[model samples]
Target: MALWGGRFSETPADAVFALSRSVHFDWRLAPYDLRSSLAHLAVLQSSGLLEDSVAEPIRGALNELISEVAAGRFVANETDEDVHSALERGLTEKLGAIGGSLRAGRSRNDQVATDLRLYAIDHMIEVAQQILALQSALIAKASEYGDAPAPGFTHLQHAQPVLFGHEIAKHVQGFSRDLDRIHDWLDRALVSPLGSGALAGSSLPLSPEVTAKNLGFTSSAANSIDGVSDRDFVAEALFTLSMVGIHLSRIGEEWCIWATTEFGWAKVADAYSTGSSIMPQKKNPDMAELARGKAGRLVGNLTGVLTMLKGLPFAYNRDLQEDKEPLFDSIDTVLLVLPAVTGMVATTDFDREKMALAAPLGFSLATEIADYLVQAKVPFAHAHEAAGKCVAMCEASGRQLHQLTDEEFASIHPSLKGDVRDVLTVHGALESRTTVGGTSPSSFKQQIKESTAITAAYSKEFTDKAKAFSEMMGA
Candidate 1:
């Protein structure tokens, strides 16, 4: 049953139908479409378009249809153009004539817009929860590796001594902001477009607020044209998902490098890793590599959607049909990625001995020597030059800065007096960074505590929001 063919004497050509069909990718929106239909049904009855006698049976049938779809007993058929068409076809079959009235005050334009919003909200909650799960794993890793000194890099070369946990916390901070962006995106996505019938709304006295409230939206769209047309929510969702992909990619890149034989800093678990086909010695971080690779796909999804939206006029367009596959693919990709990476992080073993051994290489503690000289009332330029000379002398003699004798230090600089080597140790270097958010043990522990609180707080907030939304949608 085609949704619109009364004006045409002939049926759409098979090629036309083939080009127009979206049921393959869009059938997933059936549940949201049905929920929106039920809400619209109530609004119709309340406005006297559908009498209670007709409305109640339609309601029962819609609910029954929802159950059937959930049980996989009802599904989009080959003839159905999209999820909305398939579900409407189901409803009309049940009610004979009354099911057709449910479309009285809504269009596929607004209907699809609302359904997409609902779908995005539901999955965004899931995605946000998964992000928090990854954050928790990282937090646990940070706590477990607390104050273990490692080489912190600039240009991928050792630049300073830092606690390994602090480096993990840096990733946590990025994910934390991703969580914040999700929260912000939800605020803009919560408005309903259900009542904006085909862009200009209806002549009937239908109340958009009634459907909006029933569907868990904070409010109805203010402008009827904008309601059916606005896909900013979808764009924002894509961007947020892309950021998540980028972050996961960073983790993947780091783990890939860390698991290398040359780095020897970490090892991915056997379950999360793969062996080579031809070579028996390979324990490849394939999942990490995939996560890195999928970031490009997620980014492409965003770019594709934006390009599709860029030149379109206001209100609904056929181009909007291009939005869902990319959006859906990105969501699926991120959902698939978060847990695998989290599991990898949770199960991986870090070689603390190797990391610590590398922590002081490449004169990473030269800054400490400069700071030490400044504490003795020497000019900073003189102190900096003295530290550089110390590094040069150590390099010349094939020794570490800490390996230099006191006489060797004195010859390098007049201020290289007694116990200058005291600041040369890794622990000393780490401990000396005692400011807030520093790599010192005390500061690292505090950072872990703060991150734990943040995850807990966001988890509760999103969980509560999801619960309320599900209840409002009668899910």
Candidate 2:
């Protein structure tokens, strides 16, 4: 029975246990519970709520519990209600009332909230590493494929030639933004809620700052009711993870398309691809597909949390316990999936031959051809029309615009000269794009250098954050 049941006349129906039990999901927070106890016990002894003689045994036993839980020896029953009661039962069994005295200045309300927040703060840094690993894979692939031409598409139609590296590099920017969000969310989730007892501040003269210091929070909550009740920080982290997952999904979708037989320009590595059971010859990009599908799960988890909190009133609810399960699920899904994706990306093979062949098929150099006429003093609108007509001429007959003889070119546009063919050759078209941020080889190499520098800077940032988190955890 719960500690509070002594005041109730009747025990809750057995069915209430089924509805209210969160131990199965929240068991993952057992380590955080032990850490909380350590902090609260420290403050309790310092404030003389308990003598050091009492606090000493509680601290030692709590450390042992942490090891038990870490080693997979801890389990709680429905009667234990949750981790808090389970830990209390363990302490009471070991040290008599001294264990019970540690709960003096705290309530399960603020305690569980603090545990959830601490758990989130630790996990967010991990998820950020997975994001960084994905980013590293992308940067490596981008740098590897520097200036390897691929068809750039808009609205699913071939629009122009682009270095394959630049296409992959664009998503590096998106993931970097996701990294930003992960840190911002972690910053919010790190606020401490330990001293908000029940629906009010503790009657004991507890110092929240001391507890926050012990648990690695920069500060403690300002309002007692809000501290225990508000889970917006958790929701914020989930929402950010959802966005990162979505971005991965979008990248996965592109890889799926690229790996298909219809578009053989990109090949999945053997480790990342799986063979169909019935079709021995098939090499499907299963990891990519799963990453895409898991995005929906993360998005759904975010929605589940948001829906749970939408209309609820302030302060804690049984519904708030619903938060941890979805978060754990989403984090587990992504962290497990991202490393595989990083491997897939790191090992992907770029089909330079197929990309080069496909590069010229859609009259991809039409804009450059237009610029050719524009440089010859033709008005751009007129130049655009003339380029369209040239495209139509190639489509009507079976000859490319570049294949037209000087006599053939003069028929389409009198301003066109024989040397226009020199300007339209594949090498010429790729070379003449000398504008900043253009597709020219020189421009892409410059872009690759700049992107490489950014990747190095981001690597240093993530590495430092990881070090700081390690130091804070005393790991």
Candidate 3:
């Protein structure tokens, strides 16, 4: 019989039982469920709802069940409705009548809520660690390539020359914001929802604070209905992971472009690349392609959960059962992909000569020409027009900006002196923008230093939290 089947005239149909079962996906939460049970049992004993002797046996049985599950000796059976039901059966089988007291002041509604929060907290730390690893790889690459010139593009056309490190720093800064979002979300997600019962407060004088502290939560939920009903934390976590996927996709797209023969700016390492079956010479960036493709699935998971929650009324509902898979998938996909992506990045070989060769193509020095006119005290609008004329003149003559004769420059604008040739070189153009956050070599080196420090701080934060959680779980 089902756990809640006392009022039913008959057992659920086989199809209904199979369809309603969540053990396949939620068995991952079995440990978390058992942990919540232990904490709730303590709350019950402290409130005098259960004898200390009864609670002790129940606790001992739960500890044994935890060991069994961890060692693969215990698992949910065919009749088990969910992880909670499966573990309840295990506890009952171990302690008989004493196990029945463990459920006195709790319901599956609040229980599952608490379990999911614990799952989120644990995985959030893991995902943050993976992100930090990726960042470390990026920083290592930037350090290796220090100020190597590359064409910076706008709208798929070469717009200016920039250090390759500058481009890597942009992604690093984006991931820094992602880390901030995870930490901020954890602040709200760490609250415990135990003792909320089945969408209402229990009459047994249960102390939510005791359960919250026992389970490592910073606080307890203030409202019973919201405690059981709210899945905003799951949605937020998925959104955060979606943003991570999107950032990774952007990096993948760039790697794909850079590895193409036409660009020839970088090569994916042999270990991370694959070759075609028919074409013997094709070195395919399969890792980057897959990272790009999986981003869509991550995004889809976010929308799937959001759509699942949009029309539901407040308080617990059966539809909430749909939440776990998408959350699980998002976490799994990110954890699996990030390490591979990190390897792909860390092992890449950049062709500095090729990047430098392409850096100043397509009249990329036009901006520097305009800035030269501005430095000569020409009106800003006139300087821009004069620079446009220089590009037009170069296009007409099949010559680059630096190749134009002084006579030809003089014809375009009076400020176009021979000194204009100085700024036309790629290195000169890159160095002229000396303001903070520019692509100059000095600016890029400073950025790499700052990014390294920030990454170290985040690494420490994640490590400290992981240790604290481990200590709490052991306690």
Candidate 4:
């Protein structure tokens, strides 16, 4: 018999039962569901809604169910509508009349809300840890390439020469912001929705605060109606995961470009690359390609959940059932792809010589030449014109900027004497921008140090938070 069938003469049709069951996707929430139940039981006994003797046997049954779950000996059957129903049946079977009392002050509405919150928190920590691993890989690459020159681009055309380390640092900073976003969203997600039984506050005088604290939340949801219906936490998590996908896609695009024969800036390790069928000499960056492709799926997951939550009423509805799959898919997608992308980044070999050779091509030193004229008291507008003239001359003669004659240089501007050659090399162009956060060797070194420090601080915070969560989970 169904848990709520007492008021009805018939059970749901087979098709309806198939559509209503969430055990296939939501079975992962079993542990969290039981955790919430255990916490709720404590509140019930304290409020005298459940007597001590009855609560003890119920607790024992719940613990036994937990052991069965942990041992993989217990699972939801086709007759069980959801995890809550399945566990309730298990409890009743184990403790007869007393087991049914566990549901006196709670509903599956609050139970599911609380279970998803707990699941999201634990997975967010896992996501953060994997993100830190990627960040570490990026930082390691930046340190390895410290001050090595590469072409920096705008609109897919080389615009300046920068340290290779600086290029990697940009992505590192993006991911650092992604991590900050996770931490910020986690604060909102930690609010417990447990005591908001069904659509209203429970009449059993149970303490939401007790359940919240025991379950690792810092606070309880203030409004019962909002508590049961609020899925902003899932939305925020999907948004955070979408941004992570975007950031990874950006890196993946670079990896795809850099690994190309045309760019020759980097090479993916054989372990990370794939062989093209019927093309013996071809090596493809399938890993990077998949990372790029999966970003669209992550974005779709976000949009899917937002659409699901858009027209729902203020309190819990059957529409809320649509929330879990998208949230679960987002978590699964990120967890699956992050480590692969990290491995590609960590194991790839950059050709510093090729990067250096290409860095000074395409008149990338033109900006330095303009800055040189600016230093010589020429107004920047005139200096920019002079630099353009030099570039025009080099293009007409089919020569590079550094290959131009002294008379050729003087024709552009009087200040552009033979000494103009001083700023024409890759190192000269890079080192000239010595301002803070510039690509100069000193500034690049400082950035590496700061990146290392910031990464260390974030990692420590994650470790501490994970420890606290572990303690709360009694793991």
Highest lDDT: which candidate? 1
lDDT per residue as tens, model 1, 1-475: 8888889999999999999999999999988988898889888998899888999999999999989999999998898999988998898888887778788878999999999999999999999999999999999998888857899999998899999989988889999999999999998999999889999989998999988988988999999999988989989999999999999999999999999999998878899999988999989999999999999999999999998989789788998999899999999999999999999999988999999999999999999889998999989999999999999988899999988888988997878976988999898989888899999998888888898999999999999988987886675
User: Model 4, 375: alpha-carbon shift in Å?
Assistant: 0.9
Best by TM-score: 3
Candidate 4 Cα misplacement greater than 4 A, ranges: none
After the best TM-score superposition of candidate 2, give how far the Cα of residue 81 lies from its true spot, in angstroms.
1.3
Candidate 1 residue runs with Cα over 4 Å from true position: 379-382
The order by descending TM-score is: 3, 4, 1, 2
* TM-score of candidate 1 against the unseen true structure: 0.97
lDDT of 2 at 295: 94
What are the lDDT scores of the predictions, listed in order? 0.92, 0.82, 0.90, 0.89
lDDT of 4 by residue, 1-475 (tens): 3678888788888998899888888888999988888999999999898889999999988888888998998998878888888888899888887788988878888989999999999999889999999999999998888768999999999989999988888888888998999889888999999999997988889999989999999999999999999999999999999999999899889999999989888889999999977999999999999999989999999999899889896799998898999989989999999999999999999998899888988888999889989889999999999999999988999998888988988887898878888888888878877898888889888887888898898899888888888777653
Q: Give the number of colliding residue pairs in candidate 2.
A: 0
Which residue pairs show collisions in model 1? none
Which scores greater on lDDT, model 2 or model 4? 4
Give me the runs in candidate 2 sitting further than 4 Å from their true place: 376-379, 405-416, 425-438
Alpha-carbon deviation at 260 in model 1, angstroms: 0.9
